[model samples]
Target: MAFTESSLLLPSVSGTNKNKNKVPEDKWYLAYIVYFTLGLGYLLPWNAFITAVDYFSFLYPDASVDRIFAVVYMIVGLVGISLIILYSHKSDAYVRINVGLALFVVSLLVVPLLDAFYIKGRVGFYSGFYVTAGAVGLSGVADALVQGSIVGSAGELPDRYMQAVIAGTAASGVLVSALRIFTKAVYPQDASGLQKSANLYFSVSIVIVFLCMVFYNMVHKLPVMKYYKELKVEAVTANEDNGPLTGPVWRSTVWNIVRRIRWYGFGIVLIYVVTLAIFPGYITEDVHSQILKDWYPILLIAGYNVFDLVGKCLTAVYLLQNAKVAIGGCIARLLFFPLFLGCLHGPKFFRTEIPVTILTCLLGLTNGYLTSALMILIPKIVMLQHAETAGIVSVLFLVFGLAAGSVIAWFWVI
Candidate 1:
């Protein structure tokens, strides 16, 4: 089939191809923006929650709630994705995304409400934490639904759209990082101040989510986008001999995808393992600087977020064509373990801010670039009928890596 079922369903991207199938030149940018917006909406929730590590720790001081929250969020997302795979084929992509995003914004709004209603001190800290964790899980469900559907939807679209989605995910990191920097700088450095700051951050997220939902629904209505949807449906249905799979065929189709992209899956797992094992939680808790003091963790995280954006964006300029090279680079990320360890308990200079900052940037850059590359490659290599499954597989690997890395992160302080 000329258009994979995967791409056919995603918010259509603007293609420069002059072919009859491509959207016209004027509509191209609008379509691309819509697709990019979908990517932004899918990931911003996780970024907003995770980036607030310092605030979470401040609120739930006694328990290791941050680590627990991090791992649980990923695990819940893993579970959500599993559920999505079972019934996702039965649903429409447009409906799935709007509903998911609506739920996502609601989850973020709940954060401030927890702070408003609950006692701020130790008396009700655990209660507050529980509410917050529940909210995080809600966000996870939203993430899984929106992310899997959009990527799966993009299956029939151009590779650039996938790249745009990945890049948008990285952009979320950047957005959260900036929000953290702003709120922290503005708010007073006291308990009440931190609470207010965190609330303000979530408020911004609510606005973004609303805009995203509006834009997403609007994009699908565009003449060009609607035309492609009808075109793909006609094309794929005309070849019903190998049409959408049923229960027996569905199971076999997913299994075949696993076999085909097992290596890509491994690389995805390792990349997140290396990343999740040490990111905002460890970075917020473990690293310190006598010089930067409180500013140390904040700046380091921001640096990582910015560079991660840079890495994801770099692929648009030049993606390494070889999967081996990309996979090999991911394996090498294991080195960050020892390198970080050395910073914790090595030569005095290693413990300093300069070395740690440099390493953090490298970590973000490599992680961003390699992850985007793998996501882009896996779908193209798989069969058209299973492209969405392949996208889901990639997400499955991501959450597994996140869960594994979160486990490893716990051991750091133990």
Candidate 2:
């Protein structure tokens, strides 16, 4: 799996021996960019929706629609990925990713279109609700396809590529956070301005996802990428000892993978559970300020995203060097729950924006570092043949954590 030596690298299926010598050692950076961009596209829609809580609250008027949307998105992502795993056992990662991204482009467009109509008094709340729910749910399906495929695909490559995809995910959060902050500040503080800005935000997301499809399709053409895919296929197929395990979509195959990597899976779950339980929703629904009441949630979401990106990227420099240390950091994020509560009900100073912002930043930082370390380390811990399955399973754990955390987010209101 450690593809460091020159002798180990080979020409692609159609490539020649001379082409192998021609490939610049650094060309793999292009592949990394492709993986990162896909990762960014996979999560940008969710970030856009989450960061725009004020618009949803204004539209629905009293219903906790944002929380409901977040929970529904997570649940649907889990179900969608499960179906992909159990049913659609296609080896063509490109087709799966493209179809999902195309769906993302179309679904994101539907939101602003419907919002425009609703603003003109031609549509009702239920119309907007159904549209938003359907759009968010559609994005969740795209997330499963893109995320699971990219991670699982990258998992089979060198670990650094997998880290690249995770880095792209963190970058998406940061991108959307910056976009939201700028848009909110520039747009007028009215319903019309909100609608205009929201449409612009989603429009930009559609463009990025579209470019993601274009770039990913191009990435497959790279000789280095083709070599990795072939290498993975040979690894799984060439092993004569793996008789029944050769069946990719079998229940037993999935079970065996889970059984072998239970600790890594559980660590991934705890990482997301602690982070999501209080993010977006807690920062959206709870906490307050007189001066920044309207802008507070948006800015806090930005803070979390910025720190999360910083944390995830930090792994490239100084990973904790131990799996347990990484898991410990994730569990430590649970401390955020009580700390956030203190912000809500403990000391008056704790409830202020400054202290809450500091805690939120720390939460994001720990979450980013621990989750990245565990994901980067997990596949390497398992047999190389099961690396792809391990990546998909890691995604399953992430959705489980998101589902659980979104459910917990509601308890603050209940």
Candidate 3:
């Protein structure tokens, strides 16, 4: 049987190949924008929960809010990714992504709804805290679903789309930081202000997530998207002739993909481990400025976000084609530990605000560039048919690094 049941469902490879020379236009870069928006959308939930840390911390005074949130979010995300990878052969990326978007909407609504009716700007409501934590976990699962699927999907496309996704994630950070700064500037620094700011975060995130859904649905209709998707189908038909993938065969295929991308995965892991250990936590809690007061951390975060966005965008101009050199760059990020340390316990000049701010921006710059480089490089390393699986495997490693780095943040901070 040349054409199995699965093959029958897919568009005819010969038919698709006919128009291979006539590449469909993206038309105003709509598909690119949609992918970038989806990348931004998936991370907004996590950013919303974390960015509103001030409000959550104010509400739950006894609990260590940031650390707890990190643990809950990362663990749930790790487990969710594991399950997705295990069953990826059975699932469709399109369906998984749509479901994940819906889940994001639900999770974003939880905190604001709880605040409006139950919490009501009150402090010491541990019940609400727990519910909020559950919402964070829900967002984690959503992240695993949407991020893995979309990134995997993008992996099958040209490098620019992946760059858009990476840049969009950085844009999510910048968006949240900008909102945080705006809210802080507008509202008074009090309970009412915290409540308003936090609500604004969730509300804006919700709106963007909706926009993401609309764009995501519309993207498939674009001629360019259809072209690439058909190409993927053609590639799969050519390479995977063994009919429906049985459990053993799928597992072996996954292992093969993993083996090929192990170094890339390790580089991604190391990148995040170093980054998560020092960022936001160190900037927010450890260091203080006599002049800027509470504003110091906020500004530092903004600077980091801005520089990160800059770094991610740089790849659009010039992507380092060498994977080994990029992995080496990831390893080089380890030097950031001591450099950041100098801002704390070293010489007087190093301990000043100027040095600390420079280091933070540098951290973001390196993090953004290296991460974008690695993600764009991963799919190119594997066969087109297995590119999606390879992308998902890379995400698993990224999440593991995130979880480890978050844990390390607890002890690494001075």
Candidate 4:
């Protein structure tokens, strides 16, 4: 079925002569920037919100309230994300991507408004979790749809786009650190004031998301060639081949890809999940503890983002030069060891900040490379004929990993 789809999508075979020129280099760069900025808007301020929420908890002590909020947020996010995947699979790629970006912008705007106008003083520990999950889920769905559309039109997807997205996430982390510093400087004496300042950052993030959305739409419109049209036609036909869409059409397609891909990548994802789960509190708690006084976590996050961006950008070059999937997989797997060890033993074995910092940097660098490799590997393994199916499969894998990690963290605490 995928073969049939790929044949239809490919210009050589599909015989559809729409736009033959290559995607302009400038447009490609702009697309990356838009993607990166969008990512930053979604993730950066959210990280700050997470930190602020933790700080609020200390200001207004209530364990039961916090737990209740957390559970509810997680449940809603899980359901929302599942729906998003289903929607993306069923809807046109263009609509899904555009709507997803709009949703993200809306969430960014709403959260800040809620913080500034209504919610005050640690409304719940899980408030950030709930809000962020919704924002990110919307963002993810949009991303899947947009990428699928690009693949459908172009017969190929840019491997670097994924890295750009992560890079934006890393950049946002750094920005959060800067904001934390400003918050500390301005509101040294009052925790409530600092929380209000955090709200300001969220508001600013909304503007960023809106701008990126506009930029992406504008760029998408200017006379660009068709690269993925054959891919799209192939996907439509493949769905037809599989029989009428019924219950869990997206899930069925995704699972089939997972079964086809080499188990090694799945293993790597599992290891990453386990490592992240074991150290669930580190990101929000340890980073907060270690850096809050000086806004150190923001610095570490920034460094992580810079390296992550570099790693992602370079992935295409690496694959082109090396062209070895297993080697890339192995490299990504090896990087996890230090992360796992750092989480497990960083506190006990390395009391000082230096060792922990080194460990953290290594984790970011390796993971950046690994993530890039993983993104590239997916299209190759799944076959271009089933690009849409592959995209759905890739996102589902990420969603499951995220969901599992969140659940495991909760379970461990319980």
Strongest candidate by TM-score: 3
Local accuracy by lDDT, each model = 0.77, 0.75, 0.88, 0.53
Q: Where's the lowest-lDDT run of ten residues in candidate 1?
A: 10-19
Ranking by TM-score: 3, 1, 2, 4
Cα lDDT for residue 356, model 2?
95
Angstrom error of the Cα, residue 325, model 1: value is: 1.6
Could you estimate the TM-score for every candidate? 0.88, 0.88, 0.95, 0.72
Per residue, candidate 4 scores C-alpha lDDT tens digits across 40-70 of: 6545434544545555455445543334434
The 10 consecutive residues of candidate 2 with the worst lDDT sum are: 2-11
Q: Which ranking of candidates, highest lDDT first?
A: 3, 1, 2, 4
Clash counts per candidate, in order, are 7, 0, 0, 15
Q: Model 3 Cα RMSD, Å?
A: 4.6
What's the lDDT for residue 319 in model 1? 67
lDDT of 4: 0.53
lDDT of 1 by residue, 250-367 (tens): 7776778889989989999999988988886678888888888888988998899889889888877876768888899999999998999898989999988989999999999999
Q: Relative to the unseen true structure, what is the Cα RMSD of model 2?
A: 3.9
Q: What is the lDDT for 273 in model 3?
A: 94
Error of 1 at 88 (Å): 2.1
Compose the digit string of candidate 3's lDDT tens values, residues 1-414: 021112222334475466576667778888889989998899999999998998999999999898888889889889998888889889999999999999999999999999999999999989999999999999999999999999899888888898899999999999999999899999987899999999999999999999998889888988888877877877777867777766988889898888998999999999999998998789988899999999999999999999999999998888887888889999999998998887899999898899999999999998999889889888877777777888888899999999888889888756
| TM-score of model number 4 | 0.72
- The parts of candidate 4 lying over 4 Å away from their true place are 1-28, 55-60, 63-78, 84-89, 119-156, 234-253, 262-268, 278-280, 283-298, 320-349, 383-385, 407-414
